[model samples]
Target: MWESKVNIYNVFELRSRTLCYFGVGAINKIKDIASALKKEGRKKIIVVTDEVVYKVTGAWDVIEPALKENGIEWVMYTGVQPNPTVEQIDEATKMGKEIGAEAVIGIGGGSPIDTAKGVAILLEYTDKNATELYEQTFIPERAKPVIAINTTHGTGTEVDRFAVASILTKEYKPALAYDCIYPVYAIDDPALMVSLPHNQTKFTSIDAVNHVTEAATTLAASPYSILLARETIRLISRYLPEALAHPDNLVARYYLLYASTIAGISFDNGLLHYTHALEHPLSAVKPELPHGLGLAMLLPAVVKHIYPAVPEVLADIYEPIVPGLKGIPGEAEKIASGIEKWLFNLGITEKLSDFGFTKNDIPKLVELATTTPSLDLLLSLAPVKATKEVIREIYEDSLNPMS
Candidate 1:
């Protein structure tokens, strides 16, 4: 099977150079690191986060005192939101520059962390501000030191150098641009995830599952990517339900969080497939639906949409991660059906109607989805090439889902 394949440039390559520090039950390392940073005469650290997280999680209380104790002046810009925008980046960058912050700390989920990355990019590179960063201009190499303290176990934004933000002016969808925006420090403490709401936990786990599944099937996927993706899928399949059922089980949460990080690394090294490509526009247009819910609602159909293009590859991958479908046909149609059935068993529904998306919205959504920047990248990886009409058909199919 590997004999006839020939490759031209190493276009589907994944590379990152960052020091990784991993351990079990190390949530409080953020404080210890902060104290060390302060002792080293690092002052004027800016913490970019959201108001709810800063107050509710008491992240500000722990990190703030640590910085203050070392005589480091600190400031905060907590206005970042879900699917962060360029305006927020501009505002935060200006604030960071004004305060002369030598370092930046992100203390929440993907949103605030991603927002901090965007701000850091603007601060280091573009003088035209955040709006210009979206225009595809020259990017700088150096950014202020960024410390990512991940409170959410899902988005592995801490390790990756890419920061995605939704720019409404650019068609009201998420725009992904990469730069040297990696965090100087990454702190992953599952303890922070202890207080997470049950729904949020389940939903975010679904998002991580989407990451692994999509990467396992996309164009940039490799043997390493496939292996990592499969392991992540298996771990999630085994651990997500357990974590959901026993929310306080440290062992389950630890594995789930570990799975989430691995999934993030996999997708960051690989690339997201159709589901992530489709969900961005829906979130851009809807904004009411949580990102995880949007993914859960759309992932099954997206899987079906791409399955016909690469059935055998997908079936072989799924055989190990998902049980009960091992003996089925490996053709595209049966593979798609098997994946659909598995998703249904996993309690993920296919209907957009359940989430309030109507038939009337299909055309616009199709147009939006087909035009999304991620579409070409995702489609190139798919087993099948999806045209506008095919995209429309998928959207229509998503309207009435399996009841």
Candidate 2:
């Protein structure tokens, strides 16, 4: 008999304490989390989201009636921003309290859901000063259980228990806080995604691709995470284009929705490195770039430069995912080339200038990106120690999309 000795290291860890309730096409499935909350006999429910998703995705309409049908009275907070700030969290938290809401349901993409997490965290953990919850060292005792309804598939915020909320640094530098991983329920629905515009569909799928790639390649990947990440990358590659080409393809949407969730779990365990660590600072500097598009623009360059750092691991991880390149010695580069080609075919271009980044801006961008506190977190696990200069190279490549 063969004996297996498995080793796990500094890969991302999801706390065993995080609770998750998952359902597909759960637009109507709000009843499950609602019932759970009601069983706890909660008084009121607060549905947090941004205004655009509220009007465009029809999530608000579907969710409102579903809650009413379940006899769960609720209030809606639709002011969550694209990148939510501390003030939005406070306002939402105040509304949750004013309505005597006993539970919170995040009902949109990452922005609303992330905002909901921040608000819910403070409601339970803070005594008088809710903002203090951002600084809490330990995971805050999860406040009211949060049920997330994902209308657009990106960020995997609904499935993952983590949240990203912005704060101001002492120098007034833009900073972010990672609160407790507290998503109690995730409702993923493909029907919710069918109406997404072409550009958003492109950017979000790229985001999912980034999740799978970053997670699968990161150090300390476990057997479970490896399986999940590989499958996610394969599925996203197959289905994302189909979804973009035929926006109404429920089958494509269904596959990508499932892919997003799987990728979410993969990264929630592997933790993001590389592109994401650097992307946050870019987002702070260029608010309109959209984090997903920024990642799409920078990913190919980052992968190309980082390949020499972890050639063996990248080769192993990509060989199975790229059938045509099987048995090739340089499978990592081949798979990455395949990814860049696939991205190009999908209408995604790599020029940062197209997205408002400039050649002259490279040095300042590198300085800012390297300064992210999370940079060390990612660098510690990076196959090659990413340096300030290497980061500038990635930026240079990204500045010229035509390259």
Candidate 3:
């Protein structure tokens, strides 16, 4: 739990509504969960997923049999693309409406889970569309129950009260955080993640890295967040390479999955700052840019700038990954360089230029970062002031690969 805002009495709130089950064979509980839903009159569910992930992970094998035994049916919507768009949400919402799907089951990573969150909102507010939902024409208080069966060790959308989707026409990506959107149940069965490809395994875990780093240092940070954030980085630093090397290593997958989940929880309580605020616009403009990769490119630059304000927390969080890194004043550049070199070693060597961004693109990126609907809230949480010039410099600093 976390306080909604900083107060004078060192007060904070730590409330998580979702009941999450983490371990191997965790997916086996789907039958019992589905049976309960059926008894509650939610006989049909809307399953949102991408084409490749649901099939590749074989999660459907468990889900299908369980639902059939319980006489529960599902309508599958597999149209979610990376950086999931409003159009995709609308399409899935339409499918869910057609079946009157009472519950939402998101079976992949962030993209599908995000779609499910949108579908749940639109399903409840039949008159509202994706654009209106993003615009907050009506702040949502409730939606159909969502069950997130995670297939990747990233985004933690399953366990957190956050969802993001883009408006293709506007190139606007907005984050949704409401109590109603937290999934009713979350299953983090690392068993499904073992078949994940090497690059995704790297990228997704890096997403978790970005999560804990921001959560531990954001202005809203609390001791609860800091403790879990430290452990998250420690686990990722130790287990990510092993998971990358032995894709079938269940133990490695289990720890990495655990790290991602806790990272999600850390940010859920602590909130986030600059990296996420800026990365959304990058991926929104270029749909093919993966969210984790975008965050990876911006993380070091953000660290360099924000370190002066919260050096101690940043140093401790990053020490496992970048040993001997310190929190000294004016050491921002050295720390930034160290972080860039570390990410470079982790295979995220591409500059913004590699993604077709340039000095000319910086202005547009800044405009989007500042003016987009929900981004300002995140920028406000930065330990350092996230002025336009600072945003510009961070983008500029990321343009060339670290030497």
Please give the CA lDDT of all the candidate structures.
0.69, 0.69, 0.89
Is candidate 2 or 3 superior in lDDT?
3
* Model 3: lDDT to the true structure: 0.89
- Across residues 31-127, which tens digit of lDDT does each residue of candidate 2 receive? 6666777778885878898877766876777777667766888888889876566678888888888888878888777888888887777677555
TM-score on alpha carbons, each prediction: 0.87, 0.86, 0.97
* lDDT string, candidate 1, 323-345, tens digits: 44432334444544555565566
Q: Which residues of candidate 3, in runs, are more than 4 Å off?
A: 1-8
**Cα lDDT of model 3 by residue, 52-155, tens digit:** 88888888899899999999888999999989998899999999999989999998999999889999988998999998898677899889999999999988
Q: After superposition, how far is residue 300 of candidate 2 from its true place, in Å?
A: 0.7
Ranking by TM-score: 3, 1, 2
Which of 2 and 3 is the better model by TM-score?
3
Best TM-score goes to which candidate? Answer: 3
Clash count list over all predictions: 2, 1, 6
For TM-score, candidate 1 versus 2, the one ahead is: 1
Question: Residue 273 of candidate 3: its Cα lDDT?
Answer: 83
